[model samples]
Target: MNGPKKEIPLCEVCQQPANQICGGCKLVYYCSKAHQKLGWREGHKFKCCAFKVQYSETFGRHMVATRDIKQGEMILKEKPAVMGPRMSGPAHCLSCGKKLEPMKIKEIYDFYKCTSCNWPMCGPECEKADIHKAECKIMTDRKYKCTIKYEQPDKTEAAYCVIAPLRALLMKDSNPQQYENIMALESHLEDRINTPLYVILKANLVTFIIQVLGLPFDEDSILKVASIYDTNAFDVRCLDGSKRLRAIYVTASMMNHNCKPNTRHIYLGDNYNLAVIATVPISKGEMITLTYTQTLLGTLDRSKLLKINKCFECVCERCRDPTEFGTYIGSIYCSICNGPFGNGIEKRPMLISSNPLDETATWKCEKCDHFILSRQMFWGNNALSQELMKIRKDGPEKFEEFIEKYSQTLHPNNHLVLQAKLALLQIYGNYKGYTLSELPDHLLKRKLDLCHELLELADQLEPGWSRFRGTILLDLQAAMVVQTKRDYEAEKITKEGVQDELMESMVLLQEAANILRVEPEMRPTLEAKIEELTRFLQTPE
Candidate 1:
């Protein structure tokens, strides 16, 4: 009754059928085993193999091709979700919903220990369930822009950042709405669900829901969580014992495509929901796009992120620019004036094309009568972006190597340099058990220093009333609280120490309030924290 298991023509050399497909993965037929092997050996290995499955709903706003999207048009605007103890105060374990024991708590310095998986908790009993180790490892990495870290060096000393814990929490309880929604969507996608793209979307959504909730997940409960209407995917790194798998996203996937997009995208802790808006004008019918790769680098690097991960060549406007637009302005400074110049005719006098590689590439400003050396400009800022991209390719373990190299090239206090430092801090704080007390004093100092630098940048670049700036202030305050020193005699000064700590806590809370003063709802909660800290600070001395 059934047809033969579909088999393609055999290969001539090995006489084996094609084991893979090609292009957009729309076709699957192999002629002989040798040809199949030849295809893979040639370049097929790097082709569509990484292609992910996508669903209509998961495609988000991108599904509607609202306007005449030019071949290399820009699309989509995204921001990372605010998360962790830094953003919304201290976070608890996602699995147990128990506030993880703080590493430096006054009496008992408690720490969370995860099994081989990075999922955090107080002990082994928590690991019994199919835990969120997969998502935890991915979140622990710095590439995602998540910088939560453990202050102690012991594996047991590590704990979950708010985002990871929140994801864990979502997993713990049953949500009828989420389940029904997923079921309905899954049914529609079932026929095509087996496709690689579809499979990838399904996997991304599943892992995303489970990880964000921080609880055990069932297929039925998926819909109860938010939907990934418009999202993108990241090369999330997770481990299954010695083997590692990449976490993917469907909501993040549908952010159309672009080379020089206006808005940036980030994970908001919620897998389905991403905080997105127009970095520039978003015309109707235009396929909203987001840059999956870091846009800081020039064309070559941007192309690489998309090529390797999304399996598409990006010929965006910026990428096609002969001058690399204003990105390389720092590298192409006017040699005559030895000053930066805009990409106009002003700096034409100092344009010198020494290297054959930059023959077509424009150099110097026509306005300023000064020669701008391409090589010199390349070394300053452009070089760092290129070098960092190389380092990231080596994976997270090479972070130190990347930082070391970046430090040599960029200013020690440069924003890029600070970013590299923050990456290291994240490893120490979130992934490894490097406690605050045990950390090298210099490292802690460096973390604090960078935090301040970032805060300054946030204040200057972001709008005064921007919610993002407020969130950054919140994170800084929390980090300071953790790093700040406290003295108390448990026996003699129970209530006395409590009062002092509460007072100190209020001081920190007040700073946070200044940032979120306009956010009325947050004010009450912050006030409550201040009150609680006051009460605890005043414990019967």
Candidate 2:
């Protein structure tokens, strides 16, 4: 005989008796469809995950794989617990987060105005967007009108700073669970107390919330909210791709940092729901990681940025290795040690940091033991970066000149040289006067070579389905098509040869399409290109 039947499960929303289990996870019960939908919108979508949260002294709270996860597998999808404008940027539409255009003298009051809070909004639909409702009421109730006039509309406004924090504070009463999630994040407030940004926030945001708006919150509490935003928020691109806004994801933010993280993320749809996808395979129990800085940056710059922004010194394998996993992206060539042809006895010894973790560490030549001051190297790279910026808009000629000038002193794969090559690659096929059909054979070959070099480095450093690699693959396939057509026109190859060459190009195109599959904005264009390429490949030569 069986024991007493298991008690009926309760609804997640109403806590009443429930028999219906969630189809996605099969763990939670809902009394009705309405309650189930409400539960998902509240939190279950994030809670249903293939990974689990774990704690460590090194990473604090971080996500770990619960099972062996395959590359390109969707690991987690979550909506932002809170979303708002970045602390500093041009005043944007409060509803859609799109940058507001400079208004004409007559159209300003009629079109761009939000009737509820007197804030800037794009249209009637945006003014009524649910995201703006809570903050709109607060502004209206307090009689605090937006003072931003149409005059000087292009200028960055400090007034925009209060919107995000205000929304977060309001969430304390309206959405306690989300407020708790925000509070659970590490703020590093003690370390940030005396910083210049903190001081500015205190004067502007804290004062406005307490004295001006009459909110029932103290200074530290408000500053903690700002600090939480600083530490955990992700830059979510607006739907139109015009600008980026700050959003705080509860579970997604818990992933720890790695220089070569195993996962990449994309914002899905207009809702800004984040989907974290594994870029590489992971064993069960392995820690899930994401890069906080650009993978293309050298160890010094990446480390410095992480320290300043995230308040943690990353000692990841890539950061500790001065050679940066043998790519030597940050190294300088030792011209004195190697002859012009390079000493044939051994590979050219590049100058690498003695201790990459220490900013003041000396960079010594591996072959001759010649040393240079770290400060000198730092400032030298900065100067070169500034020069590169100045000439970047001057076209491919300037890029080639910059690469040639720096090749003698810097390693071939140095970040600055790579930047110039990347710039040239973009220009060779896409820019006017340098289109693929217009490019000389020599220039076309240069573009192909740059694509190959960058892809090789990307595989080593970033690896898997990275957007950077996807873009390079797209360029590579286009160059291949152009080269093949040019060769066929020159009678350098037969119909069979042309088909063979294009088959290889098709493989690259397919891979690029796969990599960009999750990117909603890029997906349609890629699909159209794929269809076009398929038709061309199928046609007789």
Candidate 3:
């Protein structure tokens, strides 16, 4: 009898049998020098095959600076070890994570249920893709058809949830070593099993994985796979034209959390790799961090989310400081002048803590001696929040009304106001009837002001080269360039004035481009804008 069949690693580029070996490191195989060169250009060269994926006692399995790593350095770039549609999300194709229009997929892409298994896939290419094959083979062997559809009470996710965990189980056999690596990662099963989702998981996932798919694993072990996904899965963003695809990274997941993170990551669409870059200098042996929670939220909100999701209370310097390191993203507007209540006061009260942390905290106006209870402060915030929520349904008229009404008592930089401003900014251009060309000079100025305000607040709250700042800066630059062009055409300014304006706008655009160029999807548009501005700037002043 033949011994166990030798495994052949496929070429990364063309997904073909690769007999030729990579000379740099023997970890990969390539079909030819041409494909090898293509793979290297696409970032296989930085795979860190020689470096050991080390473990730490303090932070668990984390990647460290073996030597001194500099700011803006690509610390890690990795394709997802396993990726699929997110739990509680809409229906999507299992292979590519794109939204599944079942009929459209069937008609246009020739997507069909596998002849053996009856699971959906775009074509033979996607049918045989690594993402689908293992799980597909197992499901087909067991004669499992996805009985669930888009209209179920779970709204497509009930059946979809099984795909990732099933992939985990299948990986145990097809790729045992990789399965071990994933198993070695933290699960936080004990923490997650206590949540409400577990009740549903028990009712659906447990039954399906054991009974429907006919896996031999015990209930506890199966749930462990789910908890691992809950605790560690990172949102992979839009990839392969798929919305909100989440992935598990063997190396990147090793990084811990920090409120004011020193590192930032960009998703490269070319090969589905995430590139982690240093936003600030990282010293040797320092634990690398990624903000698992949204940095845009205020301190109490951030803490609450972290506690609820990740099962830990953060004590980072940002969390410890009641004022959120002086950004005051959580602060209320001064009830009188709408200034930030503690403008210059040393003993200013700003959100000591939220529920479960503290019942209440004082909110005293240091300058004006206006006393508002902690409960009272949040009450006001809640009222503002309720009104802000209506803007989505009530439309632009309501947004302007809400802003004007709140401006009387709330600071422009108040979180609620910022939320409204952000909403309004998005609407002013992209929304129907509010096109940029249709906007008057004063309206353009208003849009410009909103961008500036948001950017200033972003600098204070979400600092460094952030997506929020980059997006707003691009909007600001675009608006300024349009306004400048209008001014020049109407003879409102001299050639020198137009040149000066273009120069100023170019600075902002360049900064926006630099911050955004790392993202593959964001690069082309920003590059085009930068080129347009550069051409305008070169014309005689």
Whose TM-score is greatest here? 2
Backbone clash count for every predicted candidate, in the order shown: 81, 0, 0
| Model 3 bad stretches (over 4 Å) | 1-70, 102-116, 119-125, 150-156, 239-242, 334-390, 393-395, 408-410, 489-492
TM-scores, all models, native as reference: 0.33, 0.89, 0.79
Error of 1 at 322 (Å): 5.7
Q: How much is the lDDT of residue 133 in candidate 2?
A: 91
Candidate 2 structure quality by residue, lDDT tens digits, 299-330: 98998888888899999999999999999998
The per-prediction CA RMSD against the true structure, in angstroms, equals: 21.9, 5.2, 9.7
Which model, 1 or 2, shows the larger lDDT? 2
Please tell me which predicted candidate would have the highest lDDT against the true structure.
2
Give lDDT per model, in order: 0.43, 0.87, 0.72
* Ranked by lDDT, top first: 2, 3, 1
Off by over 4 Å in 1: 1-61, 64-126, 130-232, 235-246, 259-283, 320-330, 334-541
Check candidate 3 and list the clashing pairs: none
lDDT of 3 by residue, 1-541 (tens): 8899998789878879989876544567788899998899899877633223467665556655544556566677788777776775655667776665554443453235555566555556666776777777777777777643434322545567777877887777778888888887788888878689887888888898788778888888788888888778887766345556678888888777888887788777634688887766667666667798877666656766787777777777777766665666777645543445434444333333333244255665534656567667667767777777756643466777777886556545667767777877877766667778878777788899999888877766667776777889989988888899898899999999999999999999888887777877787898799888899999833
lDDT for residue 509 in candidate 2, whole number 0-100: 93
